[model samples]
Target: MFRISQYLRELAQAQATGSYPTPRERHAKGPVVIWNLIRRCNLTCKHCYALSADHDYAGELSLPEVFTVMDDLKAFGVPALILSGGEPLLRPDLFEIAARARDLGFYTGLSTNGTLIDAPMAARIAGAGFDYVGISLDGLKPTHDKFRRLDGAFDRSLAAIRHLATHNVKVGLRFTMTALNAHDLPALLQLMQDEGANKFYFSHLNYAGRGNIHRDKDAHHQATRTAMDLLFDHAWAAAQAGSLDDYVSGNNDADGPYLLQWVRQHLPQWEEALRQRLVAWGGNASGQMVANIDNLGHVHPDTMWWHHDLGSVRARPFSQIWNDTSDPLMAGLKQRPRPVQGRCASCQYLSICNGNTRVRAQQLTGNPWFEDPGCYLSDAEVGAVSTPFETPANKHARRTIEIAHV
Candidate 1:
């Protein structure tokens, strides 16, 4: 059985002792809570959901407010808080706030537009004792500016990233991939190569932002579909060729192994061929792909569509905010725990909790995130990875699909 009990137990003990747990300790041991200090940003990206005019959030988290959240989270035992915003630096008291959080024993971090990250500012942050930072770099320069709308945003951001790197600050690149940047995958990869960014998360743009929210769905989706095809084609091709193996080789042991094994199984003979393709793929796809906080305190998780209470974040006594009882989008949350059977019940990852965003999934597929798309066996020792196909059925149904042609 897939029991995460051990994982949970280890996490609890680590937090209790103020020492990070094993697997999590190796990387980031925290549950990663986002503090939306504000929502107003100088550059308007159209893909923002909480950007609507109606979304009114207090400009900043007051010291008392910040203290409340920190104390609560500390009590509840969340290990970290990632402070983001329309721009976190926009709030003048950022360092003080961060210092307070750090003093409270919560691992404090920041996400920024990089426009404000200077040597002095960086020093303040380092002195304030933030653990890490995430920098947004959609492309080298041209593409990034087009999306962020600041003329020199890309160069400045890149400069900030390099500056942080020089200061020995750990940084990760944030790439929100979109239909526009979708075809430019290779370009993005090259930029990352130049930047020495170790972590890359690809996200799809969502419908909420300043962009064409009410635009033609078919056309937009089609363009996205086309872009995805091109992007995945390169990815698949890279896997087919030897290009992926090279990237995997470049990836440190832990970093590249999963991607390598995943490609080996999915692309098979062309695994090396897949690696050969040159990629400048756009950075992480954008929008609702991952939940974020706005300048205000709206803590939104990408998978769920609801405004989570910031106080409840990392705060146990505050109670869980997104539980079905409190979330507006999840009317069915407490309805009943649907009994699983057949494929879902017996599947390896049966304790699957990841579901689609309530609003988007309901509107798009009328079905929530019922499938775990990223559940491939990335570790070679896990055994063969399989895709749905016509073959001898493992379990019978009137009509059946089997794991075939792995």
Candidate 2:
């Protein structure tokens, strides 16, 4: 994930000459862990990648087992642990686990649906010393309620956000973009500003679990560009106003190139600096810098790869699973220059995006090496004539045309 608001502030306001700071770079010693403590949720959201339900899942790691895994992760030098779930607050020992992770010196965060966080819950979360809490709210009342598959969910979620804010829990808003709710983005941004949210995370819809069923509803190319423009504008304004400076986009490393293009056109003077910073950030660090331990203790490269298990914490320690290069998928992901195929293999920004999201490619084409179908950039924008599916192009002519347009 990239914080566009911070980048814009550092570029235009601070005029900093050095590289932009990144969580990945700052915590170079260990990978960020997404630990799904539970798999039960009250609401069946349309874009739920976990495919979670209201019922309890069998084989969840026991409390002692979870503690053992947490200890191992801490010993392995994991810097941050994000407690996620169908709804993490639903767990009986949620706060206890969070407190334990904090005590173990891990920067703990919570990912939730927000409906379950009442006043008491908010206080407990704040007391647990959670570094951050990200609550998902798709849109305004009607839209959000529909997406969440429940009426009054919007109000409940908003109440939770307000309650968290009152307790000074450092809460943020998480909105997953799709064709059904993209139009509500402006209103959601205003809501964030009005609610005094500390951050805003705009997640592009990824095809996994229930999300795969809605892939057809993912934002189109032009719509995605327009939405990004709105986000950049809003984030830039927020930065200038000295409020809500953390604006992030996730599940799409194409966003990096998109932002670079935006800076080139709007903030031309800082383009080179932003480019250098982005390159250093080294996009899509799924297998290398991020890992997921599901509720059942299966280890994946990232949270979205529940279908692709690299190893199991129940079988081997997370350190051993992460360090082992025996798994073909894990080994390929660790390779600096991955052996990607199609447009990804030819992309000039390979160093910047690291082949984008492999999971998306694998889902769409049934091959991880194939280019990500979610990449919305045009051939001209990516400095390519065509992809494998498109007609072969005259490279010189295409380059001349693109240069002239620029």
Worst 10 residues of 2 by lDDT: 16-25
Each candidate's clash count: 50, 0
Give the winner by lDDT. 2
lDDT of 1 by residue, 1-406 (tens): 0111222233334435655343422232223466667665666765554452223355555667667766755665566777876677877677888888878877777878787788887777667777878777776677788877779988888888777877777676666555566556567666655776544444444333432263232124444334333434444444334332112111011112233334466535433432231111111111211234434344554322333333333333332543324443333432322232223223332222222123333333333333222222232333324334222343354244343422
Clashing pairs in 2: none
lDDT of each: 0.48, 0.86
Estimate TM-scores for all models. Answer: 0.60, 0.92
Tens-digit lDDT track for model 2 on 1-406? 8778867776645444454444234754679999989999999999998899999999999998999999999889899999999899889998789878988989899999999888998888888899999999999999999999999999999999999999888888999999999999999989988998888999988889888888999989788899889999988777667664589998889988999999889878778778888887888988988899999999999988999988888899999999999988999999988888787888888889888888888887677877888888887777764454322355567778999999
TM-score, cand. 2 vs. native: 0.92
Candidate 2: regions farther than 4 A off? 14-25, 385-406
